[model samples]
Target chain A: MKKRATAQEVAQLAGVSKWTVIRAFTPGASITEVSRAKVMAAAEQMNYRPNLLARSLATRSTRQVAVFVDDFANPYKLQLIEATTAALQAEGLVALLVNINEHLDHVHAILNADQRQVDAVVLLGTSFREETLADSRLRDGGPPLFVLARDSQLAGIPAVSCDSAVAMEDICRHLAARGFGRPGFMSGPRTLSTALGRHRHFRDHWASRGIEVAELQASPYSHAAGAAAMRAYLAANPPGARIDVLVCENDILAHGALDVLRHEAGLSVPSDMAVVGFDDAAPSALPGYDLTTYRQPVGRMVETLVDMLSGRRPHDTIVLRGELVLRSSA
Target chain B: MKKRATAQEVAQLAGVSKWTVIRAFTPGASITEVSRAKVMAAAEQMNYRPNLLARSLATRSTRQVAVFVDDFANPYKLQLIEATTAALQAEGLVALLVNINEHLDHVHAILNADQRQVDAVVLLGTSFREETLADSRLRDGGPPLFVLARDSQLAGIPAVSCDSAVAMEDICRHLAARGFGRPGFMSGPRTLSTALGRHRHFRDHWASRGIEVAELQASPYSHAAGAAAMRAYLAANPPGARIDVLVCENDILAHGALDVLRHEAGLSVPSDMAVVGFDDAAPSALPGYDLTTYRQPVGRMVETLVDMLSGRRPHDTIVLRGELVLRSSA
Candidate 1:
């Protein structure tokens, strides 16, 4: 690679001190308007950019946040990633994407992020065990950690996610109003931190109305898993004794359950069986699957995350409410 | 933040020189077995991680690659991202995600990557004008750039993508063998580097067989755009003059076209109209759609990219062929 232009050369051309040139590039630094203008023009002409990696050594701020993601099968994770990355960029920080999967587990991902000295780490739609975070090496002497679009019961780790309690209440009320007597809850992997809470909310809300609820667990949030779980459920129970309404933890699972119910089980949605899901993914709005689901406040949640990272807001667990979109499926 | 353990502290604990501790952490550094083992134990006891940012200044390599992605609506992009990030991690490199969109354009993203002194840059599914790359500031004194999963006509820039020439031929042959004469190609945005080649391949291949093909352009590569384009095509042409088969640029567009043909246009697939698409996205395999499309070899392409970055392979364009998955749609 060719040598880059130096800041001293730009300062000489702009007829200003080197300190003034540095101040012009630094955010919120004190510098005269005329000096900053001259310095910027000279820097642009010479193609001089301050080396962020080199500057990070002195400031201890790399301005890069490591974002850990594992569940790529769920379409809703893409929306969360886009929103979080854009929000981070708006605050002049870059997102270092760490794909945590079977190859690279959560413990190794956290160590890599800590070694890079990132400003913070954001966990998005991951399915690692809670004991992984309990490692004292990860808990001490590292950058702050935050969770986005998922609930966290761990203390001192602020999480900004949709309020599952409110969403479950809304879904149960809608189902009860429609006079659906038998309800079943379809959940993703049990390792997910948000799974137990969603199941409890759905069951407790239904028990209040004097109705018993059934449950099924699908490992790994994917359409195939959901379809297989639904297939097994249908085979074990006869048509008359089957659950009338099925509540899925996410839209992807709901899509699979709907497909099996219609094509294989020969059941018409909302007539023979009703299905509801959380996370209003884009495909749910299509003409084929007009699913009634809850839309998470992704943009607002990401904004709150950015505010906490930048010290503009206190580090506390925040639960925001979303809208319940009613459609023909439910 | 708590103070990190220093190299001197590890050296004292291990009863060795400080340089020995550094060599134990550095890859490919020469040191005795006993000394290296002793230093590693001491470093692990105190959680001492070498500061990569500080080491980058002396080595002139940050071991980070900037991945530029813009189109999130396409589900195929997520698979490419997962494969690329995992491959990079295997090579002991990190991926710095750069989201290029209306807010952060390609030029700005490139400059940011340049400022950070990343080892290389990879452009993935971006839609930017070719002239934007002609900027001298981006071309000179910057890290090497590569394009993944997209063809690049620009000279000296290596691109690893699926062979459109071969895939189009397979699609055309499949259509002709099925006795389809009136075929139309549904294209995405005109600015895409791969659009013209795909359109040309479809038109020329059909011309060789003495069959003329009709064309329609959809902007933004979204399902809604595909639906709107199909709606306009049907409104313009009568039943007798309508094209019997439609080939979409990607699976997402094909899904929209299929939905419109079935629901609004009141046409049954493969009997009244046939639809085909590329990319073989996850939804394409669902029971509802069952689309016939091409699957890009994302893992192989990412492996080739890593080889190019690590100097194990030459910097040249590589075209890999994928399989043509057949289903009920076509």
Candidate 2:
């Protein structure tokens, strides 16, 4: 490997102090433009770029954020990852992606992020448990924690997500208008507080309108799991006694449920069974699916997350409203 | 912010040297078991984990790999990202995700990764251009670069990807057996050498069997782009003049083509027009699509990449054969 040009070498070439060379590269550091130009020219000529990892020791800021994501099977997570990474990059912050699904538990992911000394940690999916986070050392002296696209019940850990209560109200109102009396809600195996909170909002919103919602659980957040859950639901309940509409917690589950209803159960949508999903996934707009779902403002949520991390916004739980997209399915 | 416990404090509490504390935390560092146990106890009590960034300065290895990904709309990229991050994490290396789509060009992403002093850089998608990479400073003393799921033409940069030649031959034989003479190939706008390489392999494989393949180009790798390309093709050529089979470069393109055929064009599969795609994405297995596609050995490819990055394997171009998954689409 070729030896990299050090700051001392660049300073010697530029006829400036090593500290001047450092200040020339440091963002927002006080340095004359002439000195900065000379240092940059010398550094460029010598193929020398300031090592961020080395400078991070003195500044105590790596300008890298640990982005924890799970539920890779969910297509919506892709949009979340893209938006979060892009937003972080726009703010000159790099995203250190931590695969929460690969580890034995979420605590391992958190501890690993802590060891890296990232500026902050952002949880992007819905799989993290509040209890696990509370019990972890992250709460003691680790980097600041922020949640995106899911509510965080842990104290001092700010979160930005869609307004699920209002979204549920919108969904229930639409279903009531369509005269769908009985509705079934499909959710994943995660027992996080936000998951339960979404279920409660969904069920309570329907109950207020004199309708009871049934609950269905999928083991994991995948299309196949959704189909299996729907298949099992059909086997347990006769067609005449089945729910009129199915409301899935996310779009992937909804796609699975819709497939089972159309192919396995031989049922027509909106006539025999209507289906709805959340997160208005990319496929939901396609003609094949034409799914009626709620669109979470992922771009806005990511912006809020970046702002919170950069101290541009207050570190508190912020909920943004999303639009309910209507289609033939519901 | 609370002050983090330093190595000095941990060493004082453990009655050991500061170097001993670092050795205990390092993976392959030499330390006595008694000293390691004492350091561990002290670390747990004081919550003093050795900072990886600080350690990277002395060791010159950050144990961080820069993973660059583009074309996020293709669902196959999700599987690649998950597998790569999981494999890297399992090997005690963190993945710093660089969003190539967000940057002005691939060169910016490379330079950003270079600034971080990552141990290696892995390109996970096919959108990177060799000319752009060659023009960048990456060719001049940057970290070792590796390409995953795509062939790299640059000298000394190793790549691991599916064998496109064999895959095309398998596809062509299947098409001939089905008596489909006229076929169309749909590709994205990336003009990289590998993109043209796949096209050449497909066209040449079909030509050797006395069949000429038609070409179609999609500006971007998205469902909407695919649909637009298919719609344009159908508009330009009427029913009798259209190709018998449409082979998409990726699953997302095939999905768009399939949706247009079924809904807008009012054509049936394998009768009026048959469609095939590469990369058996998650939705390809759904009953709604049931797409005939190629399945890349993502797990095995990621394992090879990690091994190559860790110096366990030689830095050479590896072409692994993928399977031709048959379904009703073709």
TM-scores of chain A across the candidates, in order, are 0.94, 0.94
Candidate 2 TM-score restricted to chain A: 0.94
lDDT of model 2, residue A116:
88
Q: Local distance difference test, per candidate?
A: 0.88, 0.87
Model 1: how far residue B253 lies from native, Å: 0.4
* Per-residue lDDT of model 2, residues A1-330, tens digit only: 568888999999999999999999888999999999999999999889888888888889999999988878987888889899899999999999998884458887788788888999998865877888787577787999888888788788888999999998899889888888888899877575345367789888877778788888887878988899999999999978999899988898899999899888899997899999999988888888899999998888899889999999889999999999999899
Badly placed stretches (over 4 Å) of model 2 are A27-30, A193-196, B26-32, B190-196
Candidate 2: tens digits of C-alpha lDDT, residues B250-322? 8988999999998898899878999999889988888878899999888889999999989999988888889
Query: B38-68, model 1: which lDDT tens digit per residue?
Result: 9999999988988888888779899999999
DockQ of every model listed?
A: 0.76, 0.78
Q: What range of 10 consecutive residues in model 2 chain A has the weakest lDDT sum?
A: A189-198
